[model samples]
Target chain A: MRVLALLDGTPADPDAPLIRVDDLGLLRGDGVFETILVVGGEPRELGPHLDRLARSAAMLDMPEPDLAAFRRAVDLVLGTWSGGPEIAVKLVFTRGVEGGDGTPTGFALGMDISPKVIAQRAGGISAVTLERGIEPGLAERAPWLLLGAKSLSYAVNMAALREAERRGADEVVFTTSSGSVLEGPTSTLVLARGRTLTTPPSTLGILPGTTQAALFRAAERAGWSVEVAPVDVAELYPADGVFLVSSVRKITRVHTLDGKALPDSTGLHTVLDGLYESEY
Target chain B: MRVLALLDGTPADPDAPLIRVDDLGLLRGDGVFETILVVGGEPRELGPHLDRLARSAAMLDMPEPDLAAFRRAVDLVLGTWSGGPEIAVKLVFTRGVEGGDGTPTGFALGMDISPKVIAQRAGGISAVTLERGIEPGLAERAPWLLLGAKSLSYAVNMAALREAERRGADEVVFTTSSGSVLEGPTSTLVLARGRTLTTPPSTLGILPGTTQAALFRAAERAGWSVEVAPVDVAELYPADGVFLVSSVRKITRVHTLDGKALPDSTGLHTVLDGLYESEY
Candidate 1:
């Protein structure tokens, strides 16, 4: 909720003394965004965040913005920030708030830097299933309606997260009403098997995440198999290791779910965090 | 789309300089807006629009803006305009783009007067039955998600409209997957039976329309029965009359759906349009 308002390249008064007409993202919720952790003024997963941003924009049918300029905007704010230590940087890019007649205009981008990180809870996160993520039709038949886009229309996503938090958990994992596992609100779902680190395939309409990519490489280096497959709720709860992966809070482990304790292993979390820090 | 940008109350450069963070509606999509049709430099439905804007803010859990000041800002723009035949006026209010963590800061209020009007077709509209309107569970249990408030998170609503337009319709009427009729992408769905003009109830989660309320009043004065009830796709195609209602384009007739011609209702369209203009 704490955000820095970046208008053009300069940080403006959060009270942007403006009677603005267009904010398509905030209006129709018509845009895409990303959240990257800034560690010592460097964005945590630049390449991956940009990659997902482009994909989500396409899903929303928005005319893509200049990705390079967007990256520079992030860096410009990071360059000027004097806040000590590390913080989460959130970038929101929306199709300018006009043209409901179906023609897209330019885009509006806002950046919020150094959000207070809830230091990773030592014991790990507790989560529960939410049916909001279910696709009503067959996967092949479901039109990708904002599913792939990290559009500013994220009220439901935030709502689901709150639902999980209210239930005494740090995060929530989305599930189909049929109980098939979907991804976390802002993170990718990943778990370790006997020797394999597995996550859901992107074709399941989940955002293709950069953190999971890096972890895949890390898993390879640790002599583990990496597979992208559909995972079920039953399988997730009993996994050898469970965690949610994102750019800022690299790897948050799930210690419990629905009142049951998940068998834990710090091996995946430690190794993944180590890899994320060293590489990015 | 061409637009005009104003800051606070002054006309400023679109690229005006600013501070770094505005954690307002931009990040959370926490805002509400209304687009009114300006007829002869006068806002046609200012009272109803402001009423709905306040309702949308309250639904999304944000405080309402000062309507006296908001109307003043809108009037300032309208008063200055040289008389035009007609124009579109948009009013936007955000929890003034900065404040709390995952909470509303305040809101930004912006208004734009555009030279646009609803592009209605000569004969009328055709539509497709998209099953994506209301989620199955919420459609029955939590009607709260669908009724009344006009929040800015409208990606899917716009998408449904786009899909209808693509199929050569001016607008679309959404149907439940199980075949119950919902409302249009941006208008209320109505069926006329003899002297009765019936629309779907807000209990079904349709955005209640100022225009629809006017229609109900006019129908009553004309000695017609006015009803609000659920209809199915079959009833829509075989109805005594069908129309989409909104602020600017008060009543657009639905002439065809799929390939079947609706029973010709020239009498209904003429009666409705006359009542809409003279009374509404």
Candidate 2:
């Protein structure tokens, strides 16, 4: 079953035409969105996702989103959702119709998690490093680039995924021009070395991964050391474990890099998986 | 008055809802578009704009757009349009609805040129040089960056324009990290030194400006020299003339750069304007 709700907490027909053609979100991709996982009709990490949505809107110079309205929309959708093991809830906020009033467009949609995403989580994925063409330190200085903002302008990310498909990989791990490992197109990179877990800092202009933060918190309680630092592309090959994490997918191990098999980290994977399950 | 048309050449209500909420064009900015200036109900440079649209689609790995259908839509919109001095015709083709059949979505919208656009063309504009964060030549090697494709993923471009406004400028001239001049967010940079006209080449991964190409053809016919080369940001300050060109705006002189006044080039401007008029 699918459920859709407007920002005002009004339920909408999911199959009907919704957004206007001239909406800036459709015209120029001037929008922000969040994808959250819902288990047993309960949305996970809704607070963080809404916070990120507001942060993204702020970065785009848009007015602050009404978190209460978004929360109502989410609750409305969840109220209508039929029983399901998992659903991916998406929240979208746009700059509204072009040449019209300044009111923004917003929506909430709840749908089943894709089988591929679930399969990837269970069996892991292969990724290839693709140069993002931006220098490592440039994004922090260039605010206009909107580097860390998870806006709807994801054509490059989609293109990178297509490139990964062309290279016979399932996913892409974007790297800076100088070979610093940045993050996945839609996920965060997590590296395990011995008892320590490392993730690249958000200061590198990558999205601060919500799921990764949750996992780090859980792991910390479980006695796993956590570190946020710059990561090098070369370190992936020699790391004790490498994984990609997202809200919907939860956690996915990286089994191969550039067609070469990575060393198995089944023990670490089990530990991380248990940690995530225990907390979430 | 505004006119809207579907790909099948059917007219639609401009005030009505059109695109579905799940359309990938709005969801992920997976789309390509073209804007053509219609003067006296005739679209200027329709052929070149359509060609560029197809090229952009190819770069995005999207299916080749049916140019005949787009042409029909444009004709339909113009036929319905009441008399106007100028109209901007926008054609959009998107990857269709997410999780649906593989058909594409297309539309043509014709609306009046904004007064601000007309005013800018008549009085010129001031621009600030903002670093694009990408290194020079990196775009050529990183095809996934979608540098030249005019995709709907323009949030960064919009953000840069906002940044320009914050700096008390009307427009933004994007520059590479190393200070090589790129193009404007929505236009092409044209520099005049002595009797020669220079524009940065598409090899720099900038869009091959359709208006600039037409201007160059006119310039060549007028016995002026034209050169396509890498331009430095410094050239704008000392050049005999600097201008931004787009299909709708046509030609706009750059009166100031980073708040400093630029030299006036009335003679060159008149010559170029006459040349454009004579040809178009």
**lDDT of each residue in B179-248, candidate 1, tens digit only:** 8888876778878878889887776666777788888888889888898777778888768788887766
lDDT of 2 at A191: 98
Q: What's candidate 1's i-RMS value? A: 4.2
lDDT of 2 by residue, A1-280 (tens): 6789999789999889988889999999999999998897778888889999999999999889999999999999888888577888899999999998989999999989888998998888999999987666777899888888999999999999999999999999999878898999999999999989999988888999989999999999989999999999899999989999999888899999999999997777888988987876
| Chain A superposition TM-score, candidate 1 | 0.86
Cα deviation of A222, candidate 2, in Å:
0.9
Weakest lDDT window of 10 consecutive positions for candidate 1 chain B: B12-21
In model 2, the Cα lDDT at residue B99 comes to 92
Question: Model 2 TM-score?
Answer: 0.99
All candidates: interface RMSD: 4.2, 0.9
TM-score of each: 0.82, 0.99
Per-residue lDDT value at B141 in model 1: 48
